[model samples]
Target: MFPEPNSELPEDPSAPEEAYLESPHHGFQGDRGAAPVQAAIPAALTIAVSREAGSRGSTIGARVGQKLGWQVYNQELLEYIAQEGTFRQELVENLTPGAGRWVEDRLQELLREQNLSQHPSIINLARLVLTLGAQGEVILIGRGAGCILPRASTLYVRIVAPLPDRVAYMSQWLRLTEEEAAEQVRLRDQRRANFLATHFHRPPGDVYQYDLLLNSSLLGEDLCAALIVQAARAKPGALRGKGL
Candidate 1:
C-alpha cells in the first residue's frame, strides 16, 4: 500500500548558498517556493536507516524512498537543520555527539547566542527529525534518528556487513584503494558510533531498537530495500499514505 511521492518539502528562505550545493541527486527538482507546510501525516510512515560505514545505508534509503514514492533526506537534513541560523557551518559540519570538539564548543556558543530553547545540536536535530517524521512519507538517513524517534511511530533499520566486505564495497563504489577504503570505513564507523553513544546513550549497533537488521553484503542494496518495503507493509497499521 505504498503511496505517491509527497515531494513537497518545507522551504527555508534563509538557507545559505552552501545549503543548496548539489547533493548526489540534484537533477530531481522539488518545490522551493512554499513556506513550511506541515502535512497531516497520521499513519504516515517514516524510516530511519542507520548503518555501519560502507554498508550503503544511504543508497538503500534512496532506493526505498524511490520505490515507495516518499522523500528521502540525507545530506539535505544538514541544510534544513541549519537554516534557522542557530548553527554555524563549521560547527554543524564538525559537531559530534561524542566528546566536545572545538567545533562542538563553538556550536554551543552559537546556540547560547541565539538563546534557542533547544541548546544542544543533538536536541535540535531530534526536533527536526520528529517534525519531518510527523509530516510522514520520509526516509531519514543517519544523524541518529532511529534512536531519537519513538519506536512505535517509526521503522528503524540497521545495515551492516563484515568489516572486510564493507571495506571492499567502499573501494569498489567510491573507486578508492582498498587501504583507503578501509580507513574511510573505520573513521566513519567510529564517528557515527560515538555520535550515537555520546548523545543518545545508545550504541549504534544495538539490536533492540531496530525493526529489521540486514547485512548489505549478503542482500545487496536492492534486495535489502525490497525486504524493508515488504516488512513495512506487513507491520501493523500498514503504511497507507495520501494516494496509494
Candidate 2:
C-alpha cells in the first residue's frame, strides 16, 4: 500500500476566494439541487473524519464507508465543487494537487471579497455536507467539514499518529528518504495549521473540536473504523433533527 503523506497544507491563505474558485470541492453552481446522489441514500448516521497528515484517516474513512455501505465524501467533493461552480474540471484538479496552495489562496480571496452570500460555493458545500448528514450515512474527510457541521447528528473524529510514525509512513508511501519525509511532514503540518488558524480562527489540534481522537498507528485503520462505527451507532440522538 502506498503510504499517504503526513500533512497537507492549503495552497495560499491570502486568497481563499481563489482557492474556492479553483477548488473542485467548493460547490456547484446554477441549479441548486443538482447533486441527487446525496438524496438517494437513506438517513442513518454521519461521520466526519479529520486527521493529521499520514494518519491513515482516509483509509479508515473508506473502510467505515464500506462497512456501512454508505457514500464516502473524499475526493468526490472535488467533482461536486467543479460541477456546482461550472469550473473547468481540469483546472480544479490541477489546483487540488497535493497541498493545494492556489486553491487556498482563492478561498481566502473569496471570503474577503464577498461575504458568505456572494460565495455560494463555500456555503453550498457546507450545506451539501449537512444535507448528506441529514439524508443518509456519510464519511467526510477534511475541508473543515467537521467544524462547519458541528451540531449536526454526526460523529466527529480526529486521527493522529506520533511524529516518527507519520514520518515513516510518508517515507514509504512517497518513496522518499526518511529525512525528506520528515521535512515534508513539517512543512505540510505548518501549512495546515496556518490555514485553519487564518481562515477558521481555530487551532487545528484543538481536542474540543473532535468527539473522539484516535491514534492510527496504535489502533490500525480497521480497528479505528470499527471504533468510529461503534461510536456512531451507540450514540443516541446523534443524528436526529440537527441542522446546519
Candidate 3:
C-alpha cells in the first residue's frame, strides 16, 4: 500500500560560481522519468470498533475479523506499545480498559516537564495506528481510533446497548453482582468519556463521528456484522488511495 517513490531530480544550474568551479559534475542528463507510482489495493478490511463496557464489542470485532480473514488488533495494540516502549505487555494491557484517565493525566504531566525531549507515548500510539492502517487492514478496538483517523476510508462503528442490558451482560461477563456490575459500567463509561474529551476535545457520545452506530440490544451481532460488510462493500472508491 505504499505510494510510488519519487525519482531523483536533475542537478541545479543556479549554484555559485566558486562551487560550480570546484565541482566536477556539469550539464544535466536527459530526464529519465519513471513510471507513475500506483498504490496497492489493501487486501483486508480496516475497522474501528468503539463501545461501552460489556457491549460485546470485542467479541463482535473478532467475528468480523475472522469472516474477513483479517487480524484482530483489540488488545494486541498494547502489545505493540509494550514492545516499542520496552514495557511489560501485561502491564500495558492492564492499563487499557479504564486506565485512560490515569494515562492521560500522567502523559500531560510528563509533557509539562521541560527536560522532556520526545512526544508522549500517546502520540506514539497514534503514529503506530496510522502506520498499521497503511500496511493492509486490521480491526482496531477502542483507544479512540475513530477520532485519530477520521479522514481515512475507515468503517467506524459504535456499539451501544441499553443501560439495563449492558449491566446484565457485565454481571455475567465479569462474575459480579447486578449492583456492582451497574456501578462498574457507569464508572468505566464516565472514565472513557472524560478521557476522550480531555484528549480529543470532543464528546465521546457524538453520533456524527461514526458512520454506523448500532444498538446491540436491538440488532444481533451477526446482523450488525452483515450490515457493516454490506455497507463497506457498496461504497465506491473507498479503497482507492487519495494520498499516502
Candidate 4:
C-alpha cells in the first residue's frame, strides 16, 4: 500500500549533520541505501502504544519491537512531518530504493481519501501511520497513533502511571530535580492533550479506546512489554513475522 521499510537501513556517509540530528535513526536511506523496513509485512499485525510522558513508552515499544522483530516508529514521525523545504522531500526520498516517487504518489492518494490538504504535518503524519498500518509489523509509539491505526488489525495500548510515579521516573532518568520533573510531567501531559485534540479530535488519557490499558509503574516495563507482545500475537488478521 505504501513504500515499505527495508530490514537493513544503511546510513548515508555524506549526510549533513542537521539531518542526523533530525532523524535519530540511520540517516534516511538515500539512493545509495534501501528501505528501512522488512519486505514481507503485508499481512502482519501492528501495535500502537500510547503512554504518558516519562512512562517509558518508547522504551517498552523498543522492547516489543526487539522481541517481535518489528520496527518501532517514535517521535521522528512528528519531527519529520514538522520540517519544510528540502528536508520533507528528503525524508520521503530516503525510504525504499525507488520510494521517493512511490511515497509521493501514495501520499497524495491518502490525502485525497481523507479530504485533508491544509496541514502538511498532519498529512505527512497520516501518511506515515496509514502506510505503516497497511504494511503492518510496526510498533508505533505516541502521536495519536492508537487512534489513527485501523482498529481491527491493530493492538492499541495505553501505558500510564500515577503522576508522582511518572515524576520520580523522569527525575531519575533525566537527572532533574523533583519539582522540575513534576512540571515537566504536567507540561508533557498538557501538550499531548492539546496535540490529540487538535489533530485527532479526541481527548488524551482516554483508556476506553484501547485494546489494553497497562499501568507500567505497577506491572513494570519488561512485564508490560511482554503482555503487549502476547496480546498482539492474538490480534486477528495478523501473521507472525517469518520466525517466532
Q: Give the whole-model CA lDDT for all candidates, comma-separated.
A: 0.72, 0.68, 0.66, 0.74
Superposed by TM-score, candidate 4 places the C-alpha of residue 97 at a distance from the truth, in angstroms, of 15
Best by lDDT: 4
Clashing pairs in 4: 5-37, 6-35, 6-36, 6-37, 7-37
| Candidate 1 Cα deviation (angstroms), residue 151 | 1.3
Q: What lDDT score goes with residue 164 in model 2?
A: 96
lDDT of 4 at 195: 84
Candidate 3 stretches greater than 4 Å from native? 1-34, 40-45, 79-83, 86-119, 236-244
Candidate 2 C-alpha lDDT tens digits along 87-182 = 433333433232244234434554565422334455555445544554547788876666555344568899999999999998998999999999
Cα miss at 182, model 3 (Å)?
0.2
**TM values, all candidates:** 0.65, 0.63, 0.66, 0.68
Better of 2 and 3 by TM-score: 3
lDDT of 3 at 130: 46
User: Which regions of candidate 4 deviate over 4 angstroms?
Assistant: 1-42, 81-117, 237-244
lDDT score for residue 157 of model 4: 90
State the RMSD for candidate 3: 12.8
Tens-digit lDDT track of model 4 for 1-244: 5436854445678887667566646666546666576454225678988889888888999999999999888876555654544654554454554434444565566455653344767776766666566667888888877766556668999988888899999999989999999999989989988888776667866778988899999999899999999998776625234233
Candidate 2 lDDT score at position 71 = 79
Candidate 1 lDDT, tens digit per residue, 82-190?
4565543443344233222322343355346542235355556755665565556788899877765555568889999899999998999989999999999999999
TM-score for candidate 4, residues paired by index: 0.68
